[model samples]
Target chain A: MSKSSFVAEAVKKYGQDRESLMPILQYVYEKKHYLSKEDMQEVAEALDLSSADVYGTASFYSFLDTKEKGEKIIRVCKSISCDLKNKEQIISAIESKLNIKNGQTTPDKKFTLLETNCLGWCHKGPAMLINDNVYTELTPEKAVAAIEENL
Target chain B: MSTDKLQKFKKRIDLIFSDVNWKEILDKALKTSADDIIKELIASCIRGRGGAGFPTGLKWKFAAQQKSDKKYVICNADEGEPGTFKDREILDKQAKKVFLGMAICAHTVGSDEGYIYLRGEYKFLVPQLEKELEEFHKELKAKKLDFKISIRLGSGAYVCGEETALIESMEGRRGEPRNKPPFPVVSGYLGKPTVVNNVETFVYTAMILKDGSKQFCELGTKDSRGSKVFSVSGDTPNPGIYELELGMTLDEFVELFGDGDTKAVQVGGASGFCVPRRKFKETIIGFEGIPTGGSMMLFNSSRSMYNVLHNFLDFFCEESCGQCTPCRVGCQQLLKGIVAVKAKEKPSKYLEDLKGMTETMKSSSKCGLGQSVPNCFNSIIDNFKEEVIY
Candidate 1:
């Protein structure tokens, strides 16, 4: 299946209405891991919306990355609760294991590291999301092990 | 049920986490008339659990009265407040209740469609929730009801928790708030009459419909009726969720949940008030005092109020939609102002100007996100001035 056809399938799964723009973008992003210029343009054309409008909506959400992302995106919780629990240590553990800093993608394109505000798991802080899977109550060892599982 | 010491403190209730017969609940609520359901909700006095504390009954009633061909019921599962996380628990434990609550509202308001806007962070729970939604639809169909509920995932943006902004995001637009007056109850969701409620609030409605309004009303104080779920975290042995009876004084709350060395408790979330040690006895934890959306973050003596306040300001700066000037600019300036104050570059007097700007944002900002910033800002600065200044 070609890229444009995948988007066409998503447009069919959800309607072509204005409301379908978000689901369509999400579907496309899930397959490609990010929305490139052409993917967003195709979504805009399919939904009969401006490319800028599609771009604006995608940019508004932290999960709807408009830029490039690797096969797996790791979002470490940086909110106050997670911060107090030493999220820096958790990030460092992943950073050393993956050989990439925060907001950077690995050379192999298998992992991307980023920090996010509150994943709603404050009680079990030091949490991170690898793609849609959530790992919580992470010690440095546990965080590294979770990343290693993906590897 | 109150003892000498316990009377001075909070009263814990077991209704929220207690067991329920969903089959019976569905049978009773579905058979009840729409008017009676709204009336019982009014009598129950249950308010929105999303921190805004709007009357849940009045919202359903207003949406019901609106004359539109299409109506909507939205369960706001976008739980992104800094310290709050009870909605996720509620959905995890009693998802059917949330769906049934939407079904009840749809029947009352004469609507056939509903949506649950779950946050992107909670995407892991999607499979189970979707599975339950299918079962819920089957139950509704067995009763021959016309209501249908679907789940929508919200890409992480805290401002989308606001109702109009949630509606806008549902329409595939930016999650920025719309101007008020024509609230979501009147003009919403494809420009139709709609009812948008917090995830926990919907659960409460389902419970209320089961046990009758009088039982729920009798639980809490006059001003705040029924129990509330509190997302308790930070500086405590017990750092999880609890459903306690409302009207507890802060002193009682601190006594129950605070660590031995606790210096303050940030009631609600970052957008909530900061109660220092001195004011705990006088502060109430309900609508009569400082109402919370159920975020109670305790801080021990070792932690710095400056750091806490800075964390919140940094969060606001990153999350602000940048549509409104007061929130977009005011958040950055406040964060910068504090750094300058702490470094002694700006005089201690400059904090007052920042306070003035918060007041301005409170009055002029487009939505609740900007308006409520003053709650944490003022309370933290006023209570922890020495920590903030030098």
Candidate 2:
């Protein structure tokens, strides 16, 4: 199915109730990487919610994206446990390797680097989640090598 | 001590990966009356393991008394607390026990439908958790049980861990918490009487039903019964899950998980108290002292106290729902105050002013996120004043 049709189908599957907004956004985000303005508008119309209502809920969450994102999103845990284990060095390594600072996407739009709260990998500190795969107990060298191999 | 020292500690209520007959417990719960189940829960003295140590039986009794056609039981799987990972382990391994716990809760509360508000980051665990749920449903069908459970994903919002905010998220709106006169027990999840319990709480309830409430009541201190599963991490050699009796002293815990150079321990995740080395011997890990939601992060001499406080403050600043002014402004002020002190831009007295601000946030903030956000900040700064200020 096409992207628009897929979103329409997801909206139908989740239902047109106001409570279906989150799931609809989630389904769209999964299918199309980030939530576009047009998609949000479509969802608002389908769920009988205003665009602002849909956008407000979407923006309140850190996972939902209002703008276009790269193919891969790298989230580094900057919580206390990871911080105690040199999270800074690991973040710096990713920046230098990707040639982009935190919260910035690469020039080619292949990767986006962002810092997040605990990813529940405290035992394995200095953890980073690239897309859906979690790499824990990371050193600077290992982080750089992992990103490079994927790149 | 080597990582092997972790084994020397006693394991109690956390039976995540253990093989057990959940069907036996379900059969027993099915045979028992709802009031009897609540009475047994009260006898067991099992409180909600979701950081707030509210009595589990009392919550059920209140919800059961309410007259409603549609009641609900919610499993708070949104384990987003920094330095906490025990719920994730439970969901990953022994998900059926969690489901059984929910079923027991539903049967006790007279609710046939349940929902697990899973955290968004654990989206990867969805396929596996759903598979487990499918099998569980098949078993329920075989046993002629009418209860059913569905999973709802939280969208990367920490505030959703709060019961009201979690309900709002379930309603598909912004995950902001509501005011409290009518708590979730009276009106929740589309304004129905709902009971929300943590993943560990549910598993423990199932265990209690299986082994008998008297067996559970006999385990811990008189006030705080049963064992707790702690997610031990940070500067420790063995950074993993440990299930222990609730009343164990911090000194004993430090001997087991702490490295030789341990300086402090952040008990109960970021929202919990930070215990300095001097107070480790006096502190207890149960309701009589500091109650935890299963996050025990240790700090060694090598770790900077200032950086730790900074990270926690930053997390609160970003995660706050911004609906309440106290939390919204208080978190920002605390974060800025700490930075100013570290840079000598403000006098050390600035911290004293921040302490007063934290008191306001503690009393006035809308939910637990804002209320307990100052815990680590105040404890770390007060305990390590020299390192934090100069």
Candidate 3:
């Protein structure tokens, strides 16, 4: 339940190197769903580093954040290629179906909707990333099914 | 999509790359006058399809004028930005065109060697491209040509997309941007003169050589000439690649996307300027009197401006390459301020700090990443101030 125990589970895979904190943080953030503040404190304490140090490394990247963890993070591709392909309908459908507007977490914290720029999959437009998995050629119906599967 | 227009366009392409033999294409293009090529290019007024809308011919002339025995022409295929994917499309679909284009640029610039710098994740695209290159190389070798080229894969670092950073990575260093002033046009790659261009830019060279600059210039606006390939994504129908003339307003573009059902469009990529719904019609994609070949569109109401911007800023914060104070430290501080504002945690205290830092980022920083990273912040604050300000 605490950050150290969470990290204790990770020590074997990540090793005890404080320098590995960023990589470890990335892994844990991906696994645990989000980088919790308490987890940041735990990482700092476990690595014998200051919380500011841990926070600095965590906050440095766009992928990691200290915000309250969401059940799902939807990064929709809004870059030019995807834009040409109609990413808007997918965003609106997903938002309406999820009952949460863009950038908002559901009341149950089942999802956090965010519109991400290009995931580099231009040929397949209207794409979204559910957690780390990329779902390409997405439609409004398909988006709902994908979220439901996660839920 | 009228048949006449489409037929005319296809006819133009067929007429251009008519000769299948690489040598024939090269010989025909080479014998064509550079002045004529420049003329056609200016007429087309095609903007550099790369992120920057710099005029392609002007850029070539600058590098061509600088007398250097070791000048290099680099094709930037390191497409790493999140929403952008047009470069890869060209590289994957019309690879022969890409190579043939590069060859023309090399010939025009009088460079003997060229390199195609691609992003690492493009693992699938590289091998296929390499095979095509081999065929082209073999044909050139058979023809007894002096020109040579090689491919360098970028290791998943967004910062390397910067010309200077790209030069560093090609030289086998960590992919971080270096100080400029001695731009790549002067000192680059192996400390030799280099002209780094987007994949589309080189591709256009083939067109210019084939068509003549004057003809090419005639396609787009008088100032911003040539056709632009926009990666249209987001809300609307037919979200795919659209090749349009320069000076096409965003409203016209959105209408092409299907109906008027749209919210915002993120022109350029992560480092590009964002035009809100209100200003979409007024903005025209172009360079210094030209259009950049790289136009990415982000659409739809499903996306919130706040989240899109936060994600962009966060990407900049992580990928600053840490080479300078403004970009390295300033990005982090700005991210913190964004988070604080979003959470409504001491919002006023961080707003001015964010503003001051953005001004510094724009004023200082070594390259485009540091300087333009602030644009993400500025656009969001100006366009989506209500969404961001708690």
Candidate 4:
């Protein structure tokens, strides 16, 4: 389906009320991996909201990235629990494996690695979120293996 | 120091994680009058398990008293605190109880609509939660209850865990908090009379009804009643969730969860207090000494206190919704202050100036995130002054 139609479909599915804006934005964000200008404009027009307002709300959330993103987004948990568990090692491993640094998307547009605050998997530290899936208790080997599956 | 105190330390309870026949509890709650249910809740002495320690019964009663037809009950599943993951565990394991608890509140507060503002990081659990909600709606229909629950997603904003911000996010806006005076119980979620509670708080409300008020009230101390679910992590041997009765001293907690070389415990999360080993004997893990939203992270001698402090400040710097000046500026300045002081850019006495800034933030900041930054800041700096300075 066309991206504009996808946004229109999200608005229809979630309803045109003010309450449905987050779901609609999330629907588009997940499908497109990020919200573009046209996508936000399409959503705003469908919801009868201003494009700036739509962008404002989208930009407020970390998950609703305004930047261009890859097919998969890896958000590593960087909070203290994960840090103590050597989260840095996990980041280094993924960076070398993908040949990209943290906060940079791979050249092939397959993965974007970023650091996020506590993923609420404190007990199982060194956790990461790839798209929607959660990978916890990560070693360098485990993180690479998990990323390899997505490839 | 004393065996008598040590013996009373770790009383592991199973009210939260245990499998419950939720229908029996719902039938009992549904049959009882709302006033009577409120009375039982009050008598049970269960406070909001979401760290604030507000009386849960009073919150329900206030919403019940509101003369609005469209009262809403929200389950705050935005579990964003650093070491706090018990809410996720509860929702993952006993979501049925959480749904029923919301239904109980809905019936009590005279509302038909409910929402669970789950964090976006936990999107992985959405499928499981949706499955539970379907079963819940079916159960509600079978019982002929005039209530329905919907799940709303929070897009990676920690401040949304604050009830007003949660309400704002639900209304499809920025998650920055609003001023108090019209708390969520009175005016929340599209300006309706709303009751917002933590995942564990709702489960306890249901569990309170299930076990009767007397059973819950008998468990803990006067100030903090009933057991709380804690997300224990860091240097602990058993790093996971555990439900224990409130009012245990820090010494007792460390004995059970701490490594022998434990240096300090970061009670609560980034926004919670830090307790060193010297004061562990006197520090009670409840409202008396320090209140928490169930995040207990241990630190051993191997770790540097400076790094921990830096991480928390960095978190606050990012998570502080930039709407307010004190939080936005204060967080950035505090982070810079620590880095400069460590690098000898400023004298060590400059730490005192930074301490003054936290006091300013504690008073002037708009929300709990900024206000509570001083909790760990003051505690960690004061106790680990050498580590922070050197």
Candidate 5:
């Protein structure tokens, strides 16, 4: 099915209510990996909200990506607990293995590494979330091995 | 001391996944009058476990008295507080009790629909939580209960942890906090009366119903009653969840969780205060001293006080919703000012000016995010002046 049709179907499931905007965006992101301008326009038409409104709401959240993104997103927790556990070592390992900075994606568009505030895994620090799966209690070596294995 | 001694010093509520008869409590709560339930909650003196410490009974009373046909019971499962993982554990193990508490609240407040605003980062737990909800729905159906609940996922915003901002996120807008006086109890969730309580608060509500309110009230201090689940992490040999009596001193807590080299403790999360080792003996963990929303992070002597304050300020800067001026600019200014001072580009006297700016941010900012952002900054600068300046 077309991406527009898929998003339109998702919007229809929640009806034309404005309150369904966040869920609809979430659905589109889940299906497409990132929200595009076209997706926002489609959602705007379906929900009777302006494109700017849809885009603004989408941009406000850290998870919803409007621009092009990789297939797998690796979010490193940069908050205090993870920081205390030397989260920088993990980030450095990923950078060395993937050859990209914290906010950069691989040249092949396979992976995107980003920094995020607390992933709620403070007890098991030095944590990172690759896509939806959480990998915690990470050492630099474990983080690199996990990324390489995924690749 | 060994870890066993530390374990013995703590109190465990055991309400979550305690094999309690939850269905019986739900049935009893359903049959009980709303007024009587509110009275029981009042008698228990249980407050909102979501860090605000607002009286849970008064919140229910306000929502129940709103005279609206449409009301809502929201379980604020958006556990975004850094170093606080107790809610995640509760929701994982005792989701049934959490839902039961919501149903009880809905029955009292005359609402039939509910929502759990689960955080975005914990989206991985959604399938498991939904499965639990499905089982709960079947049980509710068998009992012929009218209340139903649906899950809504947050999209990676920490400001949504605030009640008003959470309502906005549920409505599919930017997660910006709304103004008060028309609080959630009066105007919430599409301007209808809504009761939003923390995950732990609702679980405790169900537990209170299962055990009499008097028994629960007998546990803690006069001001802060009952047991609290704390998320302890950092510089501890065993870092995880612990349920303890509400009014334990920091000295006792340090003995249990703190390492020998522990220098300071962050009572709450990013928005909480920091207590140095010297003050730990006098500090209490309840409302009378420093009220926390279940975060107890220990920093050892090796950890720099300057870096700790810097990390928290950076978090506030990124998480602020930018709806209000003071919080938006104040956070950035504090972050920049601290960096400049540390770099020695700005004089140490400049910190006093920044401290005054924090006072303005606290008084004039839009929401709790702005108002409380200065807590760690003020506490750290005041307590560790030498470390911060030199």
Candidate 6:
């Protein structure tokens, strides 16, 4: 669904109460990959809120992106638990394979490289999250393979 | 039931419902005017219960002081400490209170957005919170309120419970602590001014705002005024959440649940101090205990202090966020020293090295995860030298 339609549906479901905008934005972003200005405006009107409120909500949450959408997302676990397990090596391995630095989306927009906090599986360590699914006990080869599989 | 057992159960149940007037809680949180809401919080003096004990009102004032067009509030529901479960209780029994507190905080901080970043194993709370949040949003919309909140779940890393790490995880990045020249108060979440508070800190705010600061202050100690919820697990008769005044002694707390079999009460969680039985008198519930605003697990003669320290070290070794070298590597070195000592590989000979590493971790680590990494071990060893030597 388009971002506008998603916002329209959200406004229909959760009309312009300023507080409902966060969840609405989260739902729309998850669905359309990014929240557009139109989506933000539609959300503002529905909640009887200003465009600023809608934009603030979107920018406040890391999960809700207002920028141009990426094709693929990469989240590495670089917290202590994962670090102890050699997450750095895995990060470099992915960087080498994709020929892109962390936080940069690939030229083709096929990938967005990012590091995630903990992601909760520290026992397994050296973990990475692709979109929502988590990949654990990752080595350089595993990191490359995981990226390739997603590609 | 014996009078003692009956009283124990009564105390436990009372904590969940005790003195907390639900109607007042709802009324105070549902204020139509932002000034009334901020006034209520200012009157509460509810400080952050997550160990720091900074006044909640002041924290809002700091973030609200900034003239940035965008601001944010984060509820640090990530209770990943080994023995802490109070966050789960507040989120479970008082999810509305948690949500309302977040709204009040946002309104007070001049932010239109809020997030409750909970640890992952709290899967049980997700659906419960989702339903509660759905209802809250409905009611809020019906009133045309402008702020909104959401629950973000964390997987399992204990360090993720730290504010910066929590922010990193929320941003879909690795849970490492950012340097503090720009604390979360200045730049957080999506690089916005954010205020992260514990579940108890927020819940208490709902009450304190409803009642007045003088009323909340009428309860605990002078410096630490308020009732604190303690888990009181390990070697206790009734191992559960207990609410007590800030000045309550550790012995008094132990007597409430420990049938006199208590050897030591691990005041605070694994990251807190290990007050030995002798120094029990020194342990008070509030700031003195370094509550971590978490549960209190007790240990008796059956558990060795040495073993407890060993296990806690293992947990830290495994839970560091890996960005800083001291904590990521120091934790492992401390654990290896413990193992070698256990294997009779060395005696107190390695104690100095471990102590040196512990000091380095306490002083140099980037985040709370690194700084607090050696707290439990240091407390145990410093207070109970004989235990480790043996």
* Candidate-wise lDDT, in order: 0.90, 0.89, 0.70, 0.91, 0.91, 0.71
Query: How close is chain B to the truth by TM-score, in each candidate?
Result: 0.96, 0.98, 0.88, 0.97, 0.98, 0.92
Candidate achieving higher lDDT, 3 or 6: 6
| CAPRI band for model 2 | high
Model 2: which residue pairs collide? none
State model 6's lDDT: 0.71
lDDT (C-alpha) at residue B146 in model 4: 89
Candidate 4 on A35-145: residue-level lDDT in tens? 999999888888889999999999999999999999999999999999999999999999999999999999999999999999999999999999989999999999999
- The DockQ values of the predictions, listed in order, are 0.85, 0.81, 0.13, 0.90, 0.91, 0.04
DockQ of 5: 0.91
Complex DockQ, candidate 2? 0.81
Looking at candidate 4, what TM-score does chain B attain? Answer: 0.97
Question: For model 1, how does the per-residue alpha-carbon lDDT over A1-151 read when each residue is reduced to its tens digit?
Answer: 1467768889989989999888988888888889888888888888888999999999999998888989999999998888888899999999999889999999988899999988998898878899999999999999989988998
Stretch of 10 with least lDDT, candidate 3 chain B: B9-18
Indicate the DockQ of the complex predicted as candidate 6: 0.04
Candidate 5, A1-151: lDDT as tens digits:
2457768878877777988998889988987779998899889988889999999899999999998889899999999999999999999999989999999989999999999999999999999999888999999989988898788
Across residues B340-363, which tens digit of lDDT does each residue of candidate 5 receive?
888899999999999999999999
Which residue ranges in model 5 land beyond 4 Å of their true spot?
A1-3, B10-12
lDDT of 2 by residue, B207-310 (tens): 88888899888778987898888899998878898788889899989998888889999998889999999999999999998899999999989878988888
True contacts kept of 5: 0.93
Better of 5 and 6 by lDDT: 5
Q: List the RMSD of every prediction in angstroms.
A: 2.4, 1.7, 9.4, 2.2, 1.4, 11.1
Tens digit of per-residue lDDT, candidate 6, span B1-390: 233753764563233334465445655566635566555566655567776677777677778777778888899987766556677777878788777777777767788888888775555568779998888877667666577897766655677778887887676445667888687878987888999999888777776667666777777776677677765555655655656667778777766766577777776666777777787777776764555565566777766677777767777777776778999899888888877876779887787779878888899999887788677878887877667777
Q: Which stretches of candidate 1 lie over 4 Å from their true place?
A: A1-3, B1-12
Native contacts present in each candidate (fraction) = 0.80, 0.81, 0.24, 0.88, 0.93, 0.00
On TM-score, the stronger of 5 and 6 is 5
